[model samples]
Target chain A: MKPKRTGKPEAAAVDRDHALHLLRAMTRIRRLEEKCAELYSAMKIRGFLHLYDGQEAVAVGVMQALTPEDAVVATYREHAHALIRGVSAGSILAEMYGKQEGCSRGRGGSMHLFDQETRFYGGNAIVGGGLPIAVGLALADKMQGRVRVTCCFFGEGAVAEGEFHESLNLAVLWQVPVLFVCENNLYAMGTALEFEHAVTDIARKAACYDLPSTAVDGMDVLAVETAAARAVAAVRAGEGPQFLECRTYRFRAHSMYDAELYRSKDEVRQWKKRGPIATFTQKMKRRGRLADADVKAIEGEVAREIEGAVAFAEACTWEPVEDATRFVYSEGRMP
Target chain B: MIDGEQALRTITYREAVREALREALQKDERVFLMGEDVGRYGGCFAVSKGLLEAFGPERIRDTPLSESGFVGAGIGAALGGMRPIVEVMTVNFSLLCADQIINNAAVYLYMSGGQFNVPLVIRLATGGGRQLAAQHSRSLEGWYAHIPGIKILSPATVEDARGMLWTALQDPDPVLIFENSGLYNMEATLGADAGPVDIHQARVRRAGRDISIITYSASLYKALEAAETLAKEGIEAEVIDLRTLRPLDERTFLESVARTHRALIVDEGWRSGGISAEIASRIMEGAFYELDAPVARLCSQEAPMPYAKHMEDAVLPQAAGIVDLVRHMVNAHG
Candidate 1:
């Protein structure tokens, strides 16, 4: 096959396997979310379904830089992060289905996915809520002499919250190892970033705390990976926290309930033209790193995985109503 | 346990709390106290005075005036496998950190499918007095007690002030200890050997049969004083200090009410939706038939705390108020 041109300057250096892996991960997220939207329409997956249809590159790219030992604190729109961080797609689907076998025992549905084995702290529903928790986790790691990083993920809207500023200050002052990833998708559930923040340049906000920061093309998986690798490295080296602003766009509504009245179709169409999966796949195929056949194979595999996950979720049992109050306190510790 | 050979030292409630913090820091490497002015400023109320020198800055950490930030960090630290004691200056200011305390710290364990338990101890000065006014003197422990995943402690006495911190640190859940702002200077003998006390039950401060005066925190003193005054009048009153408020040692208070047949709840918080209402509800539920008179509650007036000393005293449940209420209850029933 004749090798085509690499349209983007940053896509030229991409390797075959790495490109394929990134493509597979993003494809997996896209398929899973497509299935989730289906389930929500069918009245299966209830509550808020913040699909990561257009923001897959950020989670996939960032997860590549983290180790299994490290901790992750993500926001409600975190299915992609949880999946890329080695939480089973089955469990993620189960959690969305509100099954007892779900990651959080079905107690926390779509927005509260928690996996202790993987150290995925939560699916924090509140904006900017996980930032301080990430700081404390990093503080614990520093105090315990562990050289691990705690990555906190939030939206650009979170920059306006008091906890965000407070967390950044604490992380910088205490020299805790934390990577604050702000996925700026332009809108925070109908509120545009311009409307929400006085300083829309999210990285500059972190800079006010004297923390090193970088803003990257969140649509390009390679760009996000490179920036996150550098930030995570500096944090793990004990240079203190780093802020990452992933400038991306979400093609779908903020939630299933959103009307998209805040933005126009021309704006959505413009962003969807530069969608992460299509752009990344085309770049890979043009560079001869991935072929059309490889893309088809990856899609088939993801389809089977999503189908199996849906089956697992459908078969999962419900927690008895009698045990509703069992976990309010630690039953194992207190008599 | 109190030892005979060891001498009992009389210390203020502030000193006892500081001693407990010191003991926790020394006993466990994971235990640390972080709050505003706790280190360099020696605590807002001087409860952690000299702890910075004793435990150094890392363990006796002083945070900026970001209650939500530090308190949420405390929850995170606890989840990260460290026992952190977060001190908010007062319950009034705790509203700033209420989201972290009520939403994150109190709900994480249950919401996380019981996989993550926040072994955090949050100690805040609560209750009214000293003319700090509305912003500084609100008794909001009742608000925290309404939360599920966290335990509530009101350490009214010196022994509890010294002992409850260690026990709260041991529990594999979040515990909030409310130290009344009024009790910091109150002095009593604390056994040198005083250590971790049971944080699961209420303790009877005085024994009587005429009426049961149930209370916690600083109001325990008022109930005790009322019991003494009633004793002199030949109308004996029992005083129950509810050390643990959330799990509520209902058995102890219910048994006391069963014997006394009349109950009076003295709380520094407001009457409606306060801890007094909860105690009254429990009594009505468990000891409904064991009542000679209605289970009365003496609480602060339903209004924002005033700055004037006399007005503040009039609003709160004072010793005189408890005495007057108990005398009225006994007289009406007799």
Candidate 2:
């Protein structure tokens, strides 16, 4: 077999086993998301389904760098991160289907996936909203004399928000242990980065706050993982927050109903060819790490997991409407 | 938990409110304060004075000028298992965090179908005084009181300020605590005599038969002053302070209107769609036939408060405004 072109030379020494684990993580997310897209189209799921079809590498790569204790806060596009964090694929799919056994107790549908045991805090829908939260979580951890990093994932369009700027400055000013991850899929809803920001180079925006940050080939899982690991380590060592701009593209529209008039078909097709799942699989196969059966086995397992989630959801019940106001306060109700 | 005789305490309103914040912090480890100047500066009105030293920085956090940041963070912290107390300098600064309060905190509980709870207590210095001007000197507690998911509270008396914080903190959902700036320095004695106040109930400061004056916060003082003057003229006025604004204590107001046969609402907020307006409309909607006369209201002029001391005072609902309105109602009766 012809040697695969290495777009990243430093990524060569990541070891085949770790590379294979990354491959498996991406495979699990990819197959799960594919099923989600189908279920959404088939009307098995009701509300908005912001599929992670094109953004798999960012979740698998970045999450792979963290210990389970560190907290994660992500926007509505959070399925990949939740799956990578070890929330069962069945549970996530069931949550999408609005099941009683769902992680959020069938209350938070797709945009809100929280697992207290896992420290995966959300599916926060408000743009640029999670930055402040991630800062506060890091603030709490820092005050507790505990060394932990909080990873906040947002979109490039979030840069246009004041919360993005305010939270970034506060995170650096307070020396909070937080990693600001920007999954720049070129567009925030319908607005493109170039059209929205005067300074489209998002990593440079972090420079204004004197925080160390970088831009990575978001298409490569190893690249995101390596950058995230170094960034997370620096944050935990009390060097303060680091920002990473994962320059990636989304293959599908932003939401279930977007006409996708924002970008050209060729651009999406070009990005899809560099899909993180297949790219990692091909690399691992060339290294004799991943068997064809291994890939099939992972896919088959993820599908079964998703199927179980659907069954769970189909068996679940809506929270009683009279109890709609139940969890507005914590001690007010029991989980 | 409230004993009746212990309610009439000689404590000043400021000390009472401080008591509330103190008791709330001590009662729950989850209760913490976050806002600009809440810690080191000890709050603009000094309500949080001595709190930073007493509670320490971890609990009494001094945040940046980022109202939206800290308020949103408070919402996050509430979701994260801590009962967060977020203080906005005023309702004006509160608008900065409105997206978090109104959009995220207020609606998340319902929108998530009761899956998420924002166990947050937001304290704000509201109402106009001391010549702060157009931007800083507006009362918008009514806007918050209108929201469904969260509870709104305005502590007009020392007892309410001191006692309301405990009840607000005890609540599982988000509670907005609005303290009138003008009332903080109004001294009252604090001792074992003063007891806990419930956040749900309304109290009548003065009992009368001629008419009822329902109000909250700074306007309650004006109403009481007016009631005292009305008593001198033999026009007995019943004054009810709507300590809790959201759940409203509407039954108290209805009972007052039902007995007194006429009602006057005095509010420091603007007249149009103000909280007082809501009370008056509810009376009109529910107990119209019981009225000896149409309900009346005295609210702030429908204009941004000016910077001059007299102008700002004139724009707000002062004791003079309440007294004059009551006199007019009496004269019309004659």
Candidate 3:
């Protein structure tokens, strides 16, 4: 089934400050991703670069529901999640540039970003690999009697993996506080949802594990935030695990190298029309909660941040060849 | 088997492992045991029997047959500051969760640039003495030792079975402990005060000068028995038990080879690309000049383990084979 087009945010409940915060977050991701594409073309940023172009609202909205103490496990396409989770743009860009100053100290590149302080487990590249880690994190919290939630972000494609089903069953059976967020972007790289899953509704599959689940309009930032807030609250209250299936789409190709033959340009154009940034911005304008000057100011601030990040990445130094085998085991503890 | 002054008691290898588990759980509140039938039903090998009633369900977790899920959970739990001892029923079953072990547990610290350390310990029953057939019986310690970042250990004696768990739990990286299925019921005397032992050295079980018989796990006993039979013929064979597989202690074995001028490796794993091959290669590299003869290896035949008793015996490395090989090597060189 085609994703239902999200309606406008409620005008009466719209707060100007909150609307701008969401818009700024989405804009920052868009500008950074656009810069990454340009860098790839110029041969500066190498390796697999997965851009989170149309799924900005999902990351921004879900992040709003999380606290500093809670943990996050994200997918390979997680530059936006890393940014919104407070990983500095300079470090992230430097990491993609393979510099020692990167968050993972150049060991992990674009597909494996990690930040210990922010509790960002990693930019796990394996499909369905992060699900069990997330479940275990929540299991640790529950066993220790700590009141913390672990939010895991993955694509709807992960639903087809055995780890997804295993993790869901384990979480519910153990009653751990995990918020499983499925970004059902209508495609698993190039395969659409219909071809990948017999039961197309991702939330329904989660509910089979007796997990509390809901589907939200992913393009509408406010709708996603509301649903995520409710889910995160239930999880924190020890009501067991919760699942949120965000009906979303991605406008760009799966990775840097793509023939674009698996999908048509018209399909991409249709999704771009309802892009997360554009739809959210227009809704705020129509509600009179945002002005054109505010939009331009946000754009200006995001542009400078992206430029500074690029400069930092360009000036960063590569890790020395002698220390290439470092971190294979913890320093000073190598066998 | 009793010491000069210290108190001593005899226990089965299974009980020794149980004592290790009990000691770890009692010492640290952060330590918990999770696996299939580890709690209420006891362990599949009955190694964790009575732990459920002693520690309660919270600490002795009985998980579903989701190996990848629970093993990955153990890694995450370790990342979250809990020491988890995950048990995969057998080496064969461990293949189900090999992705989690190889991809996540072994690579987390490096992939994350040392930002995360998985202090996780995984214990699985290995080797094939029982007629459980091909699917249930395997000796894959050699395959696991090939990977970096993780530590591979094969504890053959009651002392090692009781002591290795505590040391493995203290490691910052992942540690895999391989318990041979045949040794679970073997009984040996242990010092009442016996606690932790070093995990980085190879111990010489018996000393001699004619030849060096290097082995570990169940094969260590076979080597010892062969040494006894060779002593009657005046062919003194030194026995070396490789307690640790990875980061192998080449010094002890090299010194032995330097004195004896011959080396014989016995392993239950298949001959092709097995731990014996690795040890043989190491001997060539480190003790080539000291050796008077070519290094020899007696490993399991390159075939799946069979169900018939005689066929299985023929496929594995036995005491007769070790004696025959050692006698031939000593006589040819002498």
Candidate 4:
């Protein structure tokens, strides 16, 4: 794990200890996701594996800036978000494998991972479906006076959904504590952002709702954390909601199912040059915050975590055929 | 847990629902209400009247007209550990929330593979007789009953209206309680108090041995009236009210059919592929030997209910319509 300034305008409030913690959390997510890619090719995992290969900084940076009381809502491209928020890597991977040991009991498959303890709401498969849910969670928190921020992460393409506008209005109107973090990877599946949206500046739309918003270079982990920290602070101070437009990109295709018809090889190459994990590692090596030995140790630790998850899933029992009729009605007392 | 017996009360359909909401909110800290006008508006039918003043705004929430948004939010709230009672105003309005109700909430329990249980209760006023016209008046509970992983109940009597909500709340899956607008003011006298009604069984409201009349919701009384009129003519007709539509009580239905060897399904839904058709088909499929004659059915006319009062009376099933249909069936069977 390493922390490098990367020429980002450092928020002076961020101390060395906090920076180190963010770096470790980000490394864990980056390594776990990197392993998932290999696992996908090995046929150990199947279904729609939308890897956050390049955009690890957005989830790690933003989540590290929030408190434990916060609730997280995310899209299908959210393995990084769940891991960064403390959901066990084994649970997420087993869920991807569609095993009962996984979070959501393998019911949600790759897209609906939920950890009630982590306050990680779901891996909502619908493009913009998780936004309103985030608002509802924020509403519940506000009404209960829990003083916990509800941080929601979605792709840049989610801007096209009706739920996006509806959730924004409700969150701002109610003065709820919501940090709407848009992991703007600049593409929605096979379609590029410019081709679909009339206005490319997503933060300006947040302004339309009279809400405060910010746009940040999502590749730089330290930069994202600085912006997220300020925004999270403002929202927690009862200043209503704040939107952080993370200018990032996914290195892989939208999903495993995509044939890669939309983007050019040049575009993928360009985004890869700024990949969060690689960029952060280079800076950390330069700053003496990390060593070659430390990197190996981190990778070894992550490999073991994933191995444990696979073993756990293998040992998991399938729900009995008769039990299929069990949870359908929670009121089992009925005659 | 509140004892089901003592909680039951003999009241009008409207008051019974109000008491249920109040009790649910009081009984559980996790229970809350959210809908289009559930708060300051006092509910469209005042079924949740004084709830806002009693439970305050936290428990009784008012939402914008975006049905999909609010209903979807209710599902999320349920997932977030709160029991939400979402009122859709009317079944006609539920169309707007269909995506959230049908796609999201209905399938969430199974889709999550038992990781989550949506203890959500969606209450809406359904059926016709208010002369609210085509857009406002339609019985669409049948369409919802088509979905899996959800429980559907159409409560016509006061006991059902009151008891169904509690049962729905106790159930882990999403439950939609459709209360007919026409039955709101109708009162019922249940001995000293309304008995705790089970949401899963068919109740034999009237007894006879010659012919069986199966119906539910607003059409229950009409079918019973038809049965009474037939008794005067020496035609014994049994009436069964199907309280819940989703888990259809086939045993009770088949038992009645097997005994009388005749069935007349009365429904307020449109004639094409309606619930009545389902009942007739089930009887034919399961108990073919019991039939004295092919199962008869009397359903609403296949036209969009017209606004004219006389036209409305003509299109829907009435006591006279059921009575005439039963007489024809009886004559044919005899």
lDDT of each: 0.90, 0.81, 0.91, 0.81
Single-chain TM-score of chain A, each candidate = 0.96, 0.93, 0.96, 0.91
Query: Which residue ranges in model 1 land beyond 4 Å of their true spot?
Result: A1-9, B1-6
Instruction: Put down candidate 2 lDDT per residue, A38-62, tens digits, no spaces.
Output: 8888998878888888788899889
Per-residue lDDT of candidate 1, residues B121-223 (tens digit): 9999888878888888888878788888889999999889988899899899999999988889989886778888889999999999899999888888888
Which consecutive 10 residues in model 1 chain A have the weakest lDDT in total? Answer: A1-10
Q: In terms of lDDT, which candidate is strongest?
A: 3
How would you encode candidate 4's per-residue C-alpha lDDT over B116-187 as one tens digit per residue?
667788998889867777888798877677777788898978878877887788777788999998898988
Q: List TM-scores for all candidates, in order.
A: 0.97, 0.90, 0.97, 0.89
DockQ of each: 0.78, 0.37, 0.71, 0.40
Residues B1-334 of candidate 3: C-alpha lDDT, one tens digit per residue? 4455458889999999999999999999999999999988899989999999999998899999999999999998998889999999998989989989998999989988889989999999999878877887799999999998889999999999999999999888999999998999999999888888889999999999989999999999999999999999999999999999986888989999999999999999988989899999999999999887889999998889999999999999999999999888888877
lDDT tens digits, residues B106-126, model 2? 876655545566778898988
Candidate 4 wrong stretches, greater than 4 Å: A1-7, A11-31, A34-44, A67-69, A307-322, A331-335, B1-11, B26-29, B190-196, B271-274, B301-314
User: Candidate 2 docking category?
Assistant: acceptable
- The C-alpha local distance difference test score for the whole of candidate 2 amounts to 0.81
What shift in Å separates residue B84 of candidate 4 from its native position after superposition? Answer: 2.2
TM-score of chain B of 4: 0.95
Which scores greater on lDDT, model 1 or model 3?
3
Task: Write the residue-wise lDDT of candidate 3 on A48-87 in tens digits.
Answer: 9999999999999999999999999999998999999999
Rate residue B325 of model 1 by lDDT.
85
